[model samples]
Target chain A: MILHHLYILGITVEAITGALKAGTKKMDVFGVIIIACATAIGGGNIRDVLLGNHPISWVGHPEYIVITTCAALITILLSPFMKYFHRVFLVLDALGLVTFTIIGVRMTLALGHGFIVASIMGVITGVSGGVIRDVLCRDIPLVFQKEVYAGVSIVSAWLFLILHAQGLPEISVILITLGTGFSLRLLAIYYNLEVPKFNYTQMD
Target chain B: MILHHLYILGITVEAITGALKAGTKKMDVFGVIIIACATAIGGGNIRDVLLGNHPISWVGHPEYIVITTCAALITILLSPFMKYFHRVFLVLDALGLVTFTIIGVRMTLALGHGFIVASIMGVITGVSGGVIRDVLCRDIPLVFQKEVYAGVSIVSAWLFLILHAQGLPEISVILITLGTGFSLRLLAIYYNLEVPKFNYTQMD
Candidate 1:
């Protein structure tokens, strides 16, 4: 139940971020709403589609579309003051990332997938929305280019699996995974941590 | 059954195109294969996903992946001679587009969807692989920017629907759709037809 609410929060924050990106490209309102919704739900949609799961999350719950659309409109209205909330947005986004990862891991595991698939699904759920948004906005995906974003998701997923294997209470697993993932993401940002680059420009 | 064979040809041509694009970006062999598979099957994968269809095509028939992978590898070896085959590739690509569109429409109608959804799925299956390819290559989608690509898919889909509605035999509908779609695409190229651009740069 708590996970469900956090999922909503995650999508809302993601939508705002997507709307901001679309604004950078000066997309019309329709484009903004589309991008916002894609960033909000695209990850889970991709995950479930690849996993052969039916009735993708947004399809089953149209309310999520409403939430993302509202979030996009609100972001547009508040764009002038967005700089002031940059840090706050980042924190919220971090929270959303971990929440998404946890949910992805749980969902995949519930489907009887093994750890590898669950971890991949978790990372997919956590970052692929941003990937989709960046692709639509014509930017190289940030997840592929910078930061510990996917790394945080992988760690969170593994931690959840290990903790659950130890027969820990579900709530403890959730809280601990969320706290750890969130803190790790924040610390990475604070220290400007990044995965090493793989620059290949030679003719191949 | 003939559609099944055309589907294979479509993916092969699409894979070669994707591999060539990856080569331009100096992507490694693995990247080439990934792009190839994506270009070959990504459109149908996306359509089925959005439509809530299960066991996405490539998942159910993993041989498609193998076919695309081989196509990518062969493309790399044949890159030096690719210029000589430019026109041939375009013709094959046109065939692929119509084949994919027909398959998309039939699949959606089989699932009990209306013309609108079927048409949309047809376009998605016909062109979205290119969109996904361009996005991964970090270029704005060609379908959204230039040419009569998506429009051709839309026409083919609608044509299939209309002819089928006339109580035509399945084979006749498929042939007519393919021939018209293919001819129209070639004519668009010959005439240099293009959709009007949407250039919005004003600050809002």
Candidate 2:
């Protein structure tokens, strides 16, 4: 529970940074805050909807919106320090990815879905938020482009499933899954790794 | 059934226009076609997912992709004539809006949801594709800001629901709903109508 709150806080921070990076002066504060909230919770919302969860996760808990609003204000104020912010953003993004993937898989499994369905849900929950944010901001989604993004989430989900199947403790399974995702993402970034693009000519 | 086929053909046209408008020289024909299909089918995808329908509408009928692919090729080849294509795009967009809204309401009712849910779903389906298209093009959604776009869908949805409740036949309900949406949208554009923005007070 404590970890979940902290994870959500980190999401708020990332969402704020994303909003500041995407905002124009023409947009009002409400618009900026809404965008920040969407960036923070959009992926999870889509996942929940797909899973047939009603009221939505964030809609049921308005704290997420309040946190994102505060974060957005701070981000706008700290815009001058952006040079030092990228690393922080990257770390938080990785954290968000792991947290969302774990939660997604767990939620779907609890809903009686099998491993394959849970894994797909995990990936969707992990990456759909960033996709929504990018789409709203009018940019190519990093997951769909040159990044080892969705791959990390998928691997993490598989690891969690395998661990669960092996009768590992739930806490250990979660920790290991998160660690695997974080390490894989960090290594990919360090090595500038990317997913192979589909070859059109090969299809022809 | 005839109307359904016409609706599919209209979707094909929109997919082609969307691909041409995406204008990403780096993206190959396959990528362009995938995007076009996504733009065309994304709204219905959201609707079905929300309603907990599996396999998705487009996934069940893979021929949608083929149609969209052909549309993309036509758009790409005729790119030079796109400047004068706005009128045709407008017509197709209106048709898409009406068709999608009718389908949305029909599906929602089939799911046994109430009138309000059905109407909301109608508006969501009607506007979601254009929203997807704009996002892929990296532009602020035109539906979010300009014109009485979604509003027309909403009104038409209400009209359909009211008439249906009064024991109107299915075909009459659909035709009236489409006519209402299309005419209202065209009139809104001709008259340069816009949704009123929320007025927020400064928090000193």
Candidate 3:
């Protein structure tokens, strides 16, 4: 029940981000809905499909779609007030990110995948929707460039694994992972953390 | 046997295009290989995953990845000459698009989908790879903005559905769809066809 509500919170925040991106692109309602859904669930869809987990999450729970769609619609109405909520969105997005990674790890593990695979799937589940959203909006992905995004997913995923192996209760694992992961992400943001990057310019 | 070889040809061309795009972005060899494979086989991957088709094509036939990676390397070496082969690339891309659509339709219908679903998968198979490539490279999708790219997929998919329903020989169906779709795409390039698009502002 807590996990379900957390999933809903994550999807709702992600959908609003998607709608904001679509609004920036000045897209129509159809584009808004599509981008919103992509941001909210595309990661999970990709992860599940890649792992051959049947009936995908949204397919199994139609209510997720309804929640995301409604979230998008609400975002459309709330765009004028967006600037004031930029910091709020960032914090929510961080919370959602950690929540998504933990959920991903749980799902992949339940499907009998090993810890390494679960960690990878967790990252995919956390970051992929935003990648899809940015791509659709014709922007470079923030997860690739912004402060310590994808790396956070990998770290949190592994953290979940180690803790789970120690025989922690599921709720404790979820809460500790969520708290530590969210704080880690916020610190990364506050400090402007960056992954090492390479530039190849032989052609240029 | 013949269809398998044609599939190989299609991926080769798409991989080159992906390499060229990554070159423009000045990404490293690793990036080039990743983008090339995404462009070459990403559409089929997306289509299959969406339809719950198991053992994804590249996973089932690992050689496809090898081919695309080699294709990307070759493209890197040939980048200086890419300007001269603009028309050649366009022609090959068209062939790949149609071939991909046909393959997608066959796969989906084989899984017991109706024509409508098959047609949708066909377009997705035909165009999604390039979309992925452009998005990863941070460019507006050519399919959405350039002349009649995605439309060609829809039209060819529908054409294949009609001809296929008439009990045409498999080779004949493939050839005719290939010929007509390629020609139609080239003509659209030559004449510049466009779909209507709109920018939305206030709700009113």
Candidate 4:
């Protein structure tokens, strides 16, 4: 029940983030809605497709689409107010990252995938919406270079797998994994932590 | 039989294009392979996901992954030689566009989707891989701005639907779509044609 609420909040926050980015690009309303929906659910969709999960969650549940669309429209209207809420935005984004990773891991495990695959799936699910949003807006995927992003997902997912494997109850697993991942992400953001950049120099 | 070979060639060409981009980014072998495979088949994967088509083509036919990997490897080795073959590259790329569009249209039709959806699917299948490749390489997706790219796919797909609606043989439909798309793409490239640019101005 908590995870469901967190997931809903995460999708709403992510949709607003997408709309803000679209705003910078001066996209029309349709573009804003599309990017918003993609940013909200692109990760889950990618995870589902990777695991051959059918019907795609949102396609089967249209309400999620409505929620993200409304989020986008509301975000566009409140664009000026967003700049004052950087801390709130960061906190919500961290929560989203952990929640998405947990959901992705759970889905893959339910489908009988191995730990390694599930971990990767978790990372994909956590980061792919941002990737899609950035790519659609013609920006570099933040997961590939941003501060402790995909790293956080991979680590959290692995932690979940290990904890679950050690006979932890499902509720404890979710709560612990969520706490660990969320705290880690917030710390990374506070410290401005980053993975090492892979800038390649031309040899010839 | 002929279409199969054309499909192979088209994939190989697209893979090489992806590799060429990866080379510019000075990526390692793993990055090259990922981009190559993504460039070769990401479109179809996107279409399949959008349509709820399960298993994915590459998951079902793994040889595609191998082909793209090999193409990337070979491309890296032949980087210098590729420069001398600009015309050849254009021809092959044009071929790839048409082939991908036809395959997308054909797949959607097989799934019993309407002509409009099929046309969109065809456009997605024809252009998505390149979009992915561009995004991964931190370049603007050419399909979003390039001359007649997605338009050619949509047009060809619509043409196929019309021909099929008129009771033309499947083979004839394929040939006509392929020919029409290829020529249109070639002409667009030669003339440096472009869709109207949608440069947005920030209001606030």
The runs of at least 3 residues in candidate 2 whose Cα sits more than 4 Å from the true structure, single-residue gaps closed, are A2-6, A23-28, A199-204, B1-41, B48-134, B137-204
Of 2 and 3, the candidate ahead on lDDT is 3
Error of 4 at B148 (Å): 17
| DockQ of each model vs. true complex | 0.14, 0.10, 0.15, 0.12
**Cα-based TM-score, every candidate:** 0.62, 0.59, 0.60, 0.61
Mind giving the per-residue lDDT tens digits that candidate 3 earns over B62-144?
A: 99999999999988987888899999988888888888899988888888777866776787798889888988887766675
Residue A197 deviation, candidate 2, in Å?
2.2
Model 4 has an lDDT value of 0.84
* Top-DockQ structure, candidate number: 3
- In candidate 3, what are the lDDT values of residues A55-84, reduced to their tens digit? 677655657777898898888777777767
Native A-B contacts reproduced, model 1: 0.18
TM-score of 4: 0.61
Return the candidate ranking by lDDT, descending.
Answer: 1, 3, 4, 2
Candidate 3: which pairs clash?
Answer: none
Candidate 1 error regions (>4 Å):
A195-204, B1-45, B52-130, B142-204
Ranking by TM-score: 1, 4, 3, 2
In model 4, what lDDT does residue B71 have?
A: 93
- Quote the lDDT for B152 in model 3: 80
Output the worst ten-in-a-row residue range by lDDT, candidate 4 chain B.
B25-34
2 or 4, which is superior by TM-score? 4
lDDT of 4 by residue, B99-120 (tens): 8888888889899888888888
Q: What is the lDDT of residue B78 in candidate 3?
A: 79
lDDT of 2 by residue, A30-69 (tens): 6777778777888788777766677888789878878887
